[model samples]
Target: MGQGRLPARLGLACCLLLLLLGGSGGLGSRGMPRGPWEEEQGPVAEGGPWGRARYEAVKKHLRAVGALSKQYWQYLACKVWQEGCEEEEEEEEEKESSPSPGLEADLNEQLHGQHLAKEVVVRAVQGFLQSPQPQKALVLSFHGWSGTGKNFVARMLASHLYRHGLKSKCVRVFISLFHFPYHKYVDSYKAQLKKQISETVQLCKQSLFIFDEAEKLHFSLLDAIKPFMGRYDNKGQVDYRRSIFLFLSNLGGNTINEVALDFWRAGRAREEISMEFLEQRLRLELLEPAENSYAHSHLLEENLIDFFVPFLPLEYHHVKLCARDAFLARGLPYTEAALDEVARMMVFVPKEEKLFSAQGCKSVSQRINYFLP
Candidate 1:
């Protein structure tokens, strides 16, 4: 018999039902609100011509960001609205008057541009949550040496998404430090890593997997994710959209000299260091084949990792460039002098050889603070 056609109303009802029943267990009790990160009182200006311009820019960016948030909510509602169960109306009505939970410090005004990267990360995360693909993308972020952006990004992203109407049911965001190379107990690292991936895969189809200090993941674990990184499907339909893997490494570790020296000392003869090691390890671990090399041979040559696909490493320059565009879209402008300064700043500088490390969004933000007013 042919499948029964669902009426428009019935279809919307079903969507709601699936949303409520499919992932309700994980829905945060506090629930998500709309416009998670739109600045209150809109965008503020410090005053004067420069300040006024900056204010306008901030407002423009805020509007762009806000629009994206609204689009996301509507998209989600449309997807689940049709499938909504009978009780959805009642549940929504109950929530209508409910005051939102208290704001997080990061969500508050003080932090502002300090959290740009977090904002980018969260939006990407929300995108993954609403994705149609079965396997979500994983994000891996690496902070500056001994830097604190690890938990900050995770917490901020979650809070930001929550404000935009994505509860735990729709999105799962986790960020943790690197405890590898030395764990209190044997197999603890691997076990926890594997369990986290499993949970992410089960809870949300489009997973956002991140490794803060991706470079620090164990060699064995690195070897395991190559197969899982690219598009694949059990039924052989070639599905690559399921997962998002982000590795936020300082591509040029501590100092070029130091990084090169370490590689040099290891007898890993190469004039330049490449993020390729991390990439190769991912392919070996997750992908089925590597240039048709033997399984043992590939494993022997590759590094062992504790987890699969610990954030595919992208150059700091590339990340910053992308972030700059994102920031500009949000209404921030770079004056000629400012642009020149940014171009120079974006260049990679070793810790020792450099007085500055174009700290991507953070650095640009500081520059804005100084130049704006």
Candidate 2:
């Protein structure tokens, strides 16, 4: 409130305060009421300086409070009441919002996302959806280290199906998340998975079986579904012929060696790897020693390639191509050069089959975006 030029010491103090305020991460602490929105209202109807600030502050606070509240509720319902609280409110909510016992809705909801392998995924999903009645549907999705768009794409593909009139209640997608140490009932594992499928068949009368990050589940589980991988009649009690099976995997190919070599050249030896080694690693990570033989034998015998399969051979390429088209269709700024580079990187190379796996499309796109300069 004093005149700025009245005292040299006071003036110097003001200058110092301004300098401190201008420094990095200095002005936004809790005690400071000033904010970026302190000058005007946002795009919302009630817009003003203090009003916008208050509104934004309220929203931020509400979001934080909401997250805390959610954690509190989860604790109360799962951790707390799971210890045996029979409260009526929790009971009512349980009835209203609890996931379906068969987990059809839960699984379908999880699968609804922008699946990276859009073409193959879309085709497989559509076949599953359009099957006359009681068709078995299967999807297998995999992701790379520090990569999540693969899962997001899976979700989007599922959303597309729903928008086109696919009902969640009628579809069952089994998605496996990250690998965790869990006891495998070797003898009953297949039976258990089949039982879940059987229950879905009985309840929905038709089902879409999905495996998310399938590489993480016991190999026995993958082997168990071999019979239903291709177009076929429902093996379950239900008479459904339109069942679909699909796998989306992020497993690297021989190009992983190149990536590893590049890393080594750049002085990061820890990441060197090969496709065969990766597949073997994934196999070991998922299946117990006892179950390995059964799973490996079944996979080879059934002919379900570790890669996406389409009604036609060339169609496999469509997975990556169609995804690029979709990205451009959605205004993601895909240029011809980009497309050509992707195709060249993925298809043109004679040894591509042995070199790069799905990462040729996904990992390459990511690196292209990151190192544009």
Candidate 3:
């Protein structure tokens, strides 16, 4: 009985030992638990530490793939929308840049008296439109007496160059007396002026800046614009080359008329009076100081202006032409007698000679009503 009991106990111990060995080395080819029940149930059980870690790693990988796919689709959608938006913006810009048919005809018909002035304006505008990347700003200085079509030509240019005409967002007109009244505060004014110009040019590369009554502006104020008007080696923050700067003043009116009158007295045709003659004399007059004149300004001394376009004084025939156009604009009867009467109403200078229109059809609109009614 004792021997049989001993064998049973020994057998029981051996069974226990075998069970421990099998539990320790029951790994599959991939080092996971291996058994029919374990394979079916999976290595990661719901409550165990190893089970939770394995489950979380699989979830994180799936989440990463989903995020990547979402980002890819969003990028593709944004690219498609951006391309369409860019095409629309380009088309709109092209349409705005083009000139209107009526604008061309009006400019040709309304801007009379000075044939050279018309040619210069037309050529400059054409050049500006045709250029893809201008190296310098188009700085045009219109010098003439009152009502000699200086302002009229500028208005016509603004109308043709921009879609909304003078009211366009890219067009900025600064009057000397109105915009910059405090000449005593030169430093503050200069800083403000530069800031406005820099900001405007940054916003729109093809901007138009009109300086009206420029002669009345301080000489220092005009000098502030020298850098923008001239060419530069480094273009800096804003490329002002594509912009247009127009200065309208009565600075060289007398010089222009004297040249014209001299040519007339010499019995030479108006066409013979070359631009070289006008430019040289005008430059001299502008550089020399005179009472109530812009001659002292560095703008002339530095020769920063690209074109010094002279609006020649209007003759009797030119005023008559202006009257006829005004009548037509008002939808009134066009009569030769009415046109002649309008021309006769204007006050001409040099009573002895009575050569050209002193007012240059400036009061034509007002005088037209006198003849019409």
Candidate 4:
């Protein structure tokens, strides 16, 4: 019994020694004991709340360096690319803003027979340019017989004002013969016209609208344009006052010719025939219902138009000028005899008086080749 108790005591002592070694191994796995110098300097704590704190400090340092490097590279790239882009944009704007000398010269050359019309046009354009901000769009109505340079003047205006001239996307031309050929399709034409005007103005405020053969345009269609002709303010939908509207019509041709002829017969200077004198008769003929006139439209009654430019009947000398211009355009030699011969060939109305060219310069281009040698 004494021997068995001795063996049990020895076993107990061995178990206690194994437990002490296991605790020592766990402490060694975490870290070695601090030396004398490390203890004096204060040992860095490990495997406690301080471990997570050290990891976070290293992560924050890396993020700051990375962000600074990224910002520096982005700034360098912007300096290189943005400068070139801005320069190109500025150059393009300058080119678009400057007026073309060639266009102005061409307009002055082509439109020959009407001094009054030219003066009116120049003043109107000057007014448009001088205005700091226009409240209403410039509406010009050209009334004359066919082939009286009405269309020619309109095209000239478009070419001079726009960068791409008549071909510009901002310039839109609608012919009654083409766009609104059928009178029965008035509703469709009205909707299309309104949509086009709205879309065009929305895209560009300086857009131009030309309505050729405006006399034949449906009255309802003219009514649709009333909104665009109104005074525009900052509070309005859009300020389309910078736009131009040109209406070419033959509605008051006879009245305009009669007034011009009277002036000529009275031996008065063409300049003496004031616009006011012509305006009364013209307004009467255009607003009154005649046998075969488009004067029934309320566009006249509402007085929406800004100007009524009357193109006078081209005389014999005027036709001669047109022939000379046509010859010059074709690079042909200039000759007084050639011009005189062409003018003589043209038929004039009133067999006794023979005052004006019946067809004006309408056939000048066609008749020019006959005398060209």
Best candidate per TM-score, number? Answer: 3
Worst 10 residues of 3 by lDDT: 16-25
CA lDDT, every prediction? Answer: 0.42, 0.44, 0.77, 0.74
Name the candidate that leads on lDDT. Answer: 3
Q: Residue 94, candidate 2: how far off, in angstroms?
A: 24
Per-model TM values vs. the true structure: 0.34, 0.37, 0.72, 0.71
Off by over 4 Å in 4: 1-109, 233-236, 291-294, 371-373
Q: How many backbone clashes can be found in candidate 1? A: 57
Error of 3 at 202 (Å): 1.9
Candidate 2, residues 1-373: lDDT per residue as tens digits? 2465447644554565444333322244454444344434455635433555566865775576556655545544454235334354345423332222322333333322222233344444555455555323353434343232454444554444433222354345555543322536644767777776666555443345556555556666666756555445544455434444445443432332334335445775332333344445444443443433324445544544433321111112433564465555456766666655554554322253442233333454453453244
Q: In model 1, which regions exceed 4 Å deviation?
A: 1-181, 223-241, 248-334, 341-362
Cα deviation of 8, candidate 2, in Å: 87
- RMSD per candidate (Å) reads 19.7, 18.5, 22.6, 23.8
Question: Residue 136 of model 1: what lDDT?
Answer: 24
For the record, the alpha-carbon RMSD of candidate 4 to the native fold, in angstroms, is 23.8
Residue-wise C-alpha lDDT for candidate 1, range 77-110, written one tens digit per residue: 5554543343554454344322233324444432
- Model 2 residue 70 distance off true place after TM-score fit, in angstroms: 36
